[model samples]
Target: MDKLAELKQGLEETWHSLGEGWRQLRDRASEALTRFTPVNRSRNSLEDAHSPPALASNWGLLAGDLYEDGEQIIIRLEVPGMVKDDLDLEVRGDVLIVRGEKRVEQERGHGRYRVRQCTFGSFRRSFALPAPVIAEKAKARCGNGVLRIELPKEARARGRRIEVRSG
Candidate 1:
């Protein structure tokens, strides 16, 4: 009877120790996973964080391709559903400024709609020309909702490249 009591006491103590260890491991794992997860916030959290949110509001316009031709810098803007009259282009010194507004129609009797993607309001995009471009003679055209600006370099400002060979 004494040996059986001793064995039972030992087994009970071992099981209690294992249960405590498992509880500690579960709590530690929960804490580690919670720390690794990212916190969620409102949709406009990023907008609220910025002091001046004008640029952040119209960030989609700034994302585009900028290419340079031989003597002209061509800028292609993707302005869908916009006409030539709606856009304003300006060239001040070395800077080329493009401003436009996109309008969406809102009709009555329309209930709540899911907004998976959103694009709105006015946008202003500015680019700097590498060399002096003729602003007065510069021409811009819009076709298929794509605005192309041709900034031709001044005749005197165009440099002729001379290849130099090492001695």
Candidate 2:
């Protein structure tokens, strides 16, 4: 009877340990899924007030819009929390390369981080122009956390009219 009771106690302890292990695994998996899932926030959401601007990833992809207006091609990029000095742009052939770095600033006191969604690192985005452009005459400006680049299109050659000759 004594041996049987000891065996039962050992089995109970083993079951509890297994239960605790399973709980830890479930919690870790839950946290990982939450961290990786994308969350869409409204433009005027209060969450945006305290948290930094959301980036696509650590090496985030720069988001921009490219359009043409008559003889000029315009490109606008959203680069919040960045200064003009942090960005670099270059036009190589028909590709426009934009590179920049985002630095993380810690204002709050050091403590355990519950959630970390903000990203900070170097990012580069390249765009191929739809039409030939005069890269030398391009103009760029940054204002209100947006970068605007204006590229003048190359003049198209006009078709020449030929006079008909008598055979």
Best by TM-score: 2
Q: Residues 64-159, candidate 1, lDDT per residue (tens digit)? A: 446886788888877777889878999998988887766543323434333312344566667777888989889899888788999899976788
Off by over 4 Å in 2: 1-57, 157-167
lDDT of 2 by residue, 52-157 (tens): 4442344333567889866888999877788889789999988888877666544454443345555555666777888888889999998888999999988761
Candidate topping lDDT: 2
Q: How close to the true structure is residue 91 of candidate 1, measured as C-alpha lDDT? A: 95
How does residue 97 of candidate 1 score in lDDT? Answer: 82
lDDT (Cα) of model 1: 0.65
TM-score of model number 1:
0.56
